[model samples]
Target: MTTIHNGVSPRAHAVQAAAALAASMGIGRFVYTPILPLMHTQSGLSASLGATLATANYVGYLIGALAGILIPGVVRSAAVMRTSLVVLIATLALMPTTHDGSIWFALRLVAGIASALVFMIAVSALHAHLRGQSQFLAGWGFGGVGLGIALSGVLVFVVRFIGSWGTAWLASASLAVVCAVAAWGLTPEPRPIITPDAPGTPSSHRWFTALVISYFLEGIGYIIAGTFLVAAIDLAALQWVGSGAWIVVGLAAFPSCALWAWLSLRWSRPTLLLVALLIQAVGIALPAVIGGVGPALISAFLFGVTFLGIGSIALAIGAHLQFPRAVALLTAGYSVGQILGPLVVTPLLRDGYRDALLLGAAVVLGAAVAAAVLRFRFPSDLDADPRTATSTEEVVFDVR
Candidate 1:
């Protein structure tokens, strides 16, 4: 019989969780970035339409996240995860059948909802299953998103050489299905033990508020870059350059969480978050300013390396602060920011994606400043014993 903490192997659980993230969050949610340019060339998809579709997906993600928080039993069940995986696969498979823009929007919106359920469910289950395991194991599990990104990027790239836009979506669906099967048995983790907070006592309100603001800002900045980096590179450089850069982003992101987790042992989480945001700001700007393959690859590397690490550290910090419903709160804010990312920059696309990229960099810089302020305000936040934090508090995987 299963208990709150069980005898599952951390490595096995981490690998399975990573596979789930790669399928649902990476391929299901994000395979669109690399494929958007293809759609533009072959299917007459305009930049404005693409941005609208992205916003639709973000809206769905917000709705799905809210569902997870409100319908706790459903989101926590393995059946939901399996159902989400099937829905994600079906969305990808169905994308090629529709030529209408509204239909595409509807497909992506459903995909977004499915992706969020798979991501949150997997993370919640894995957190419980991996309890008492090395924190590094958890970090490795989060790297699955990066792995999925890389795999999907490569699939799109290869299909571009031999196939059309529809083929790319189909190929991505096939890959996602395979990953879903691999992760099938890892779910339905034992229900976590809950410890109620003392009534009338809130912990670290100032620091928590600052962290959420910074994370929300980071979500906006990161999505602009994440959603459009490939298209931006395609406009400036060779077609292959954009896809190659995306692959680099995936490769760099795969190990980043573990690296940041290791760094957390020595540095404060806020300090690491600030530094990562700063690096990401520069990274997001490089493709716009440099416009060459070398600079584009560097930009991808920097973006990948920091984005996941920043997320891991920020969630960990939330736990440290003992913030109630911290993950749910932060995720909702972040999803809202993502919805705003494309809509905020729609007017700028008439000029070119360079202005949008620069805007992303500026927002990230603002996020860095937020992190710095938080660091200064609560220098001792990291000194709290993380071991005392409830497992339920240790929620979220950097699924993007």
Candidate 2:
């Protein structure tokens, strides 16, 4: 086992991990959402094309996640983390150089892959370095994404004055550079060597199936709202309302993981997750049905609050299952759902974002149903060590 450097508390390492996620997952992977409207308003990018670009990024994320699962050695490498961070910066910087949609798609794809590598490396490092530390530290670390979102939202708002989308991309990359520098000294623990579970009939673990299915459905449901929520607001409400909503999301999300972790101590993970999914469904649908600045802001707040919480609780349940590579498996399933989300809703774009929001709500409702089933079928599966709830849940999964 490896310990953090002398004088560097485990909490500091957790902060470093959070900063890495803020840069990679929040800024690198998600800065796109705030930027999408800019591209459409200024660059004449169509909604269908924007959805295609989002899917391209999600595909890259899925590929990157699969690599992490299949090649653990690579995921644990410090060199890989450093390289991915640099490449992610480069990809963002490159975005401004090209106006071609194909080129933009390729850049987003590469950014997605680089962001995943940085995210997985940062998270795995936290698990190793922060061992035996309070799980609340991990919660704060996860809050980095919301912080990054807020930062990027503010940047984009500044861009509204500057009147250039390119500057927003460049500024976001600079922030990533700062994060990379801060996290450069962060060290990863030696990868754990685990004995493989003996082969058995897969059907014996019905609960695992339900968990993965619910997580997968969550992937599909949450993303449509995440990717389009700001864009929808911009179109339906005031121009500033979209970016303002995104900032609200960031503010609400900052403390959500820690709040959810605290709640998990008293409530079962399944019940907590089910409740989150149900609330998130309403959040996702609110803007579509209600139609106003208030509802838009409320949607952003509720969506931001629950999306991360659901991921935390669901993956925590995966850890409780004690399956080999449980985290990796759930990640893969969730990634697939993300890839499918924008693509599944592309046809609905012709009808407008309201249809997409409604579709997202329906899928999230399905996810809630799955969570309810998990709770009913596996009542005792929610027990977790009071001190450790698998910080893997803390990773700021973009569009989760």
Candidate 3:
């Protein structure tokens, strides 16, 4: 394991990374879900415009991901992470100041970009500092997103009774500020020095292609639910049920990565990935098929548990493949899919969110089918060159 600067313990590093994720991913990016209902009833935000705003954010996320890939140095800079955190905070705070849809879109777009940068920086830091630590440490760090989600959900749930959508946005921004303070000292991963390499068995490109396709499909399916699940539940359940379900989602998600990491020790990543997708598909479709608070909460729980787990497992598999720029390529594909998710289901939104959720469920099943393809003749043993194998192992750990 690489030594952390200033004698920061691995646990402390994970905590900082988690705080960054909580602020950037959980509060900044996803606070929209619980707040969407308020926008609809309180602010006259139509379903079409809502979907459009969501798409704008995803587009911005793709751009940010591309920037990280193109300029690798930015991923290693604490300044970049801090700037993104500030930008994210500003975006959330500014959201309530205007009723103009265009301004909302722009704010969300910029927030998406900042969220992506924070995510990349936090993940890089976790990978660098907790290299050989228990996978549970990284899993707990990822759970920070869940913690943020739960906290924001609670905020919105309370504000819905006493305030308006603008209040929700402002409160979320305040929460992000608190998280940013905790993450202020986080260190980005240092750039590695390249050394002469030894020959090793080349990873199977065919499998890598399958992995990419599966992950891309997952991006589409996951974001649809992430954006609209609360709204969908609100359609059929009590007024409080929607936000309550969202809170359930956050609670379920908080420990999901750690659970998945523990399971990965006993099961192959591909198998676990496939199972998770299948479970998520069922969760997404549950409320669509059955209407009520029970189904809605259950759906939230299942979706929350699997979404982050899927990402962690998929990225770990990409690292194991040892393909060149595999993480970047996979991330790009996933981002593009996220950009398409809302647009692909926009037409369905006119009827209601149910059709959209059903569509999302089907797409996730498609991703699972793609994952199943990876189970055949998969390379479980990599007894190749020791140096190459060690590097791959480090990547897998980092990804987890």
Candidate 4:
């Protein structure tokens, strides 16, 4: 029962926790992208099964996000953080070992739940400590997911170079191990703020509904581009360019998250979010609709730049809604979005990407319109509570 509501702050400790959480949640995501084709060729997995595993992971994340809404949490809850990280680390290490598609799916579901707990609780911690710091404190915590994305990409590249999926799993697990140690000693100070509810608070919840729809749609739109961006490149007969394109997306994402967060300081969160969503929608549809490496690479770049801002913008908007339950509601809506994205797109995988990109484009445009409504109607820091919806959906995705 250490109270940090009005005492010595734990800003540094909060940041550390957030970084660790981000790293754990980012497990194997980068590796999953570029190496998926290789995995299918070498590991003898089917495309459908691969899709199932992804579905399971996102399903797990969705469940975890819903649980976060009801879970009683306090900032600097070391026990909660440690337990969540342990679950995430174990899943990362064990995920590659499960050959049975069903079992792998279950593990991913559990891992997603664990990750949601760690992510939300850590944000609770940062938001608590940063009550006195500028608005950007939560933004930095949110940005940790971007850094984690970068680190995960590097780990994947090294593992791909070494030629063992096991090595990548091991390396990521080791990183989690180190993070656990660092985060364990952090001050266990609880922030004690109440997050938003799922069905409660009419005005806030209505906007929450719109935001959730946008987020879920972003999930659909982004994942199609994410899952097949690499394959699409290879299909177009530009393997090297496609690979290079992903690297560029990852590169831009690392800094663009910070840049977007900074932009939130100067402009409306909803405006920036709308622009980013539209840019990504166009990027997503470009590969299928356009020809050659030039459009492909450009699509990748725009995808990278616009995508890095989404979670930040969404979470920042949640902060603006100002209802008591805004953060949790925001998270739940985002999780719902992530779950629906893959499910909706999974069936259309065989229809070529025309359906996929068009669906995605439609959804992203929907998100943009919702963002507009949000900016104009509710444009203030009403729900400035601290929390991380970064993992509420895919924070940073490079080409799949």
Q: What is the C-alpha RMSD of each candidate to the true structure, in Å?
A: 2.8, 3.4, 2.7, 5.5
Between prediction 1 and prediction 2, the one with superior lDDT is 1
- TM-score per candidate: 0.94, 0.92, 0.94, 0.80
Query: Per-residue CA lDDT of candidate 3, range 1-400, in tens?
Result: 5455668988899999999999998898899999998999989999989999999999888888777767777778999999999999999999989999999999999999999889878887776777667768888988999999999999999999999999999999999999999999998877754433223245567788999999999999999999999999998788899999899889999899999988988989999999999999999999999999899999999999999999888877776666666667788889899989999999899878999999999999999999999899889774332123222232222334
- Candidate 1 TM-score, true structure as reference: 0.94
Name model 4 segments beyond 4 Å from true.
1-11, 28-31, 74-76, 188-209, 226-231, 234-247, 291-300, 322-324, 351-355, 375-400
lDDT values for all models: 0.84, 0.81, 0.86, 0.62
- 205-315 per-residue lDDT for model 4 (tens digits): 667667766776777677667666765665664555655566656656655765776776677776787889989988887877877989877887787777747876776
At residue 53, candidate 1 shows an lDDT of 94
Ranking by lDDT: 3, 1, 2, 4
**How accurate locally is residue 28 in candidate 2, as Cα lDDT from 0 to 100?**
90
Candidate 1 Cα errors over 4 Å, as ranges: 1-8, 198-203, 377-394, 397-400
Clashes of 2: 0
Which pairs clash (backbone N, Cα, C closer than 3 Å) in model 2? none
